[model samples]
Target: MKTMIVIPARLASSRLSEKLLLRAAGKSILQHTYEAAKRAAITDSIIVAADDPRIVAEVDSFGGEARLTSVDCQSGTDRLAEIALMHSDVDLFVNVQGDEPEISPATIDAVARLLATRPDADIATAAFPILDESKLHDPACVKVVMGANDRAILFSRASVPHVRDGITPAHLQASPPIFWQHIGLYAYRRDFLLWFATQPAGRLEQLEKLEQLRAIEAGKTIVVTAIESSPPGIDTLEDFREFVARIENQ
Candidate 1:
């Protein structure tokens, strides 16, 4: 199956402005993400869908492929749809976050392969077991509840399966966790991407402010592949510094 990895980068980030262009290790964050995507054997091609000319120029300077998308594109998925219009040959499209410079190539390949193998599923995503109790309650950390056969049943900001009978937080943290943290990486069929762009904002999606819920509300099947811990994404200056320190130490 032909798969294309698209990294949607925007300059005006609320937390850390221009985080994607921030220098990390020896390369810009976007460049690092692009190079990592190139290492994935499952992807047929890699493209950076940028909203600003500055990002476009940066990608060009680094000798990486990039396409200028509309700044008005509502979300990354919308940007992916814009990129999809130019490439008709792509069968599967993987959405790789531009800020995640340390994203694993193996995780990218796994998500793409999951969608390629599961014809019934419109989308495929990755998740990792949540070992920390603090992360479970953090709304910023999205959670996923999986159904039979690794199919995603729901995605929410609140802790799922709220253990009934007044179970203490201590009990929740004990051995064998019950929840999974939703990883941002996703892969979707070309047709599904197009269809998703036309659908209006779903009720549950708007309430939770999670775009992935639009798919779940529409009764689409999203298969999940559990992966090891996902690397930290660049959301603030501190996050970028931490990434640099970790990479340099390694």
Candidate 2:
């Protein structure tokens, strides 16, 4: 099964406009992400699914493959679906976020392999342990609950597995934790990718603003793999600056 990694990039970012074009460590963010995906062993090809011509040109300038997708694509998954439409030979599609310039190739390979092996699974994603107590409570940091066989039971912004016992919140924080942080990277089977494009957003999906919830609501299994670390994604100016500093230090 061939795995194709498609990075959905747009010039008009609400938080940081043209973030993919932003310079970090003397390389554009999109270029970094594309190169990182290329490093993954499981991927047969890496393509940029761009909604804007500027982003397309940027990818082309770096000698990277890019395709112009519909600007009407509401999300990354939607943009990837458009790319999938043109490439019928691809068996697996991996959605790599454009802001995740520091995304690990190992992490990408792990998720793609999981989907490739699990015939019953519709999607595969990655998660890492949330060591920070503050991040555990942060709604911006999505949480994922994994079940037997490493399948995701649910994903939400709210903290999961509420302590039923008389354990105080402070004490619970001090104790070893079972919570995990959700990573945005996703690998979907070709059939599921097409089905996902047609389905309407479910109630849970709308409430959580997570497109993955639609799959869960439809009884689709999502396998979650554990990763040691994930690099910080560029969402704000501070994040971009920190990424630059980290690259320079390296």
Whole-model lDDT per candidate: 0.90, 0.89
- Tens-place lDDT per residue, model 1, 17-134, is 8888888677999998899888998988899999999999999999998899986799999999999888899999999999988899999999999999999999999998887778
How many clashing residue pairs, candidate 2?
A: 0
Clashing pairs in 1: none
lDDT digits (tens) for residues 1-250 of candidate 2: 9889999988888898788899977789999888988999998898999888998889989999999888688888998899898889999999999999889999999999999899989999999877766776789999998888999999999877555563355644543346788999999988889889988999999999989999999999999998867889999999999989998899
Off by over 4 Å in 2: 165-177
Residue 67 C-alpha lDDT in model 2: 93
TM-score of each: 0.95, 0.95
